[model samples]
Target: MNAFEINGGKPLRGEIIPQGAKNEALQVISAVLLTEEQVIISNVPDIKDVNKLIELLGDLGVRVEHLKKDTYSFQAKDIDLDFFMSEQFKAKGGSLRGSIMIVGPLLARFGKASIPKPGGDKIGRRRLDTHFLGFEKLGAKFNYNSKTNFFNVDASHLKGAYILLDEASVTGTANVIMAAVLAKGITTIYNAACEPYIQQLCKMLNRMGAKISGIGSNLLNIEGVEKLGGTEHRLLPDMIEIGSFIGLAAMTGSEITIKDVHYNELGIIPDIFKRMGIRLKLRGDDIYIPSQPHYEIDTFIDGSILTVADAPWPGFTPDLLSIVLVVATQAKGNVMIHQKMFESRLFFVDKLIDMGAQIILCDPHRATVMGLDKQVQLRGIEMTSPDIRAGVSLLIAALSASGRSIIHNIEQIERGYQDIDIRLRALGADIKRINTMPKQH
Candidate 1:
């Protein structure tokens, strides 16, 4: 296993550019399978999850080319349908949750799709019932194989239908949209996820000759087309990374500029940080955070303690609540973090408490953090990362601690962030990557 040894208490200075959105890239790359022509995608993050999905594409005989750094072109003209039933796919497809999205495009173009049980962070119960239910709504036959643990969907002919999703699940909506784009009639999706990633997917599909309207709203209208053509798409900068940078600046007392953020699309992220009393300024397309000796948390107007929580789109994302909780540890007041989406995301606060942060885990979904206000610096300690968001949160906590900290299970971190150690080192962070071999009994 590999760990990061971070010597903290130094302010990071310089510019850091956010990588491409991981969620968006997954959906966009999956859409390439809908058409046989070459589809070029730019600004794709070279993270483990994405690389694993790309490898899965290669296993399916999709011709993938690396045109340049963070750019790739995919041609699915010669895809090997047999690969989906191979033992190799059973292993690879179950490795990442994003692998489940392949079912949409594969079913659209090949009339059949199957995926083994998907695996990702053990945050909570991430059910695929939303996905399979959507497929069943579109006249597809859905079956599950208990022995192989695979969910299979087959459709001799797909006809569009009205789908009212149980929840606005992002991946579910994307998968259903991909399937609907090549159906035989109009498909109307109500209560769909309207995240920027989903909006981008709808726009890209439109560019590829699929007629999709209501790009930024919860109700989407997709007109089925006979076929789709190749089109080039560019991914948006990762909003989660940008939010992490904001927290890092406040926690480490750093002056950092996050470059090329699509600020207009980042609905309430900036304002949310501002509520935490972090000083942020917009410079063109960049977010500049100056060094601060102390940041204070704001209370509600009626004199109640401040609370930050996550919701669906146009609201705070559940992904950044961990970052927000970590940043609140050093603020000059108290704040309540409500992680509405995932039940177990706040469990990592116990590790932060071991490092001298004042946190009260109210339950599986709520935490109350009493900020230190720079009265005392957090002392470093050895810990293990739990999930992607929590891993980055721990890294931020380690960066601001008074002494050296060791974090294990860094693979969780690498699955999302691209070259994180190198990027932080460029900003003067004292982080080192070390691999340790297990001891024999």
Candidate 2:
């Protein structure tokens, strides 16, 4: 296992570039299975989950070439259908949550797809009902093996239909969209997840000769195409990482500039941080956060306590609520963090409270943080990272604390962020990766 040894109280400076979007990479990479032609994708983040998915693709007979740093070309000309039923597939496919996405494209291209139960963060109940239900609506037969914990979908001919999704799930929407692209006739999807990642996938599909309308809206119309060709696509900078940087800057009182962040796509992120009293400026494509000794939380217009909550696209992303909650610990006022998406994400507050931050765990979905206002410096301690976002939040908290902190299970962090220690080190952060042996039972 790996851990992070961070000496807190060092204010990071210098400009840093955010990596390509992990979420976007997962969707687009899976879409490569939709077409057999060579598809080149640039700006892919070099992270654990993304790399794992790429490795899985290669094992499944996709010709994956590493063209350059953060660039890859995939040609799925000869997919081994037998591999899907092999034990190797179960072990590899079950490890990543994103692996479930391959079912859509495979079912569309090969008429059958099977996958073991997927894994990622242990946040909460992340149901796959939306995904299988969407596929069922598109004329695919779905089956589940409870004993093996596997899912299978088969379609002799996928015909389009009006699919009113039960929820606006981003992955579900992407999966259904991929399945519908090569389907027969037009497919109408209402209440679709229109995140920037989904929009990028739709655009990339269109570039590859897939007919998809409603680029930025909840209602998407996809006219089934006979086949799709290859196309080059570039991923946007990771919005979650950018938001984490902003929160890191404010919490550590650092003057930092984040480069090449697509500002237009980061809906409600900048505004939400701005409401927390962090002073930042937009310099062309970069975001500049100045050093601040004190930042106060804002209240509602009616003078009620400010609440930061997560919703679907066009609303605040649920991914950044953990970062926002961590950043609020040092602000001048209080704020309630409502994590509407996951039930267990707020449980990390106990670690923050142990470090002397004033936080009340209202429930599984909410936490009220009373800002310390620089009057008290958080004392560092040992902690374990539960998930990706919480791990990064604890890293930010460690960066702002006094003395030193050791964060175990840093693989969770590396699963999402690429070379985080290296990037933070460039910005003068006293953080390093340390190899640790597992404790004997």
**CA RMSD of all predictions:** 1.5, 1.1
TM-score against native, each model: 0.98, 0.99
Cα deviation at 296, candidate 1, in Å, is 1.1
Model 2 agreement with the true structure over 240-296: per-residue lDDT tens digits: 999999999999999999999999999999999999999999999999999989999
- The lDDT leader among the candidates is 2
- Per-model tally of clashing residue pairs: 0, 0
User: Could you give me the TM-score of model 2 versus the true structure?
Assistant: 0.99
Badly placed stretches (over 4 Å) of model 1 are: 437-441
> What's model 2's lDDT at 205?
96
Error of 2 at 213 (Å): 0.5
- Per-residue lDDT tens digits for candidate 1, residues 1-441, read 899999998999999999999999999999999999999999999999999999899889899999999999999999898887899999999889999989999888889988999999989989898888888888899899999899888977888999999998999999999999999999999989999999999999999999999989999998999999999999999999999999999999999999999999999999999999999999999999999999999999998999999998988999999999999999999999999888888899988999999999999999999999978899988888889999999999999999999888899999999999999999999999998642232
What are the lDDT figures for the candidates, one per model? 0.94, 0.95
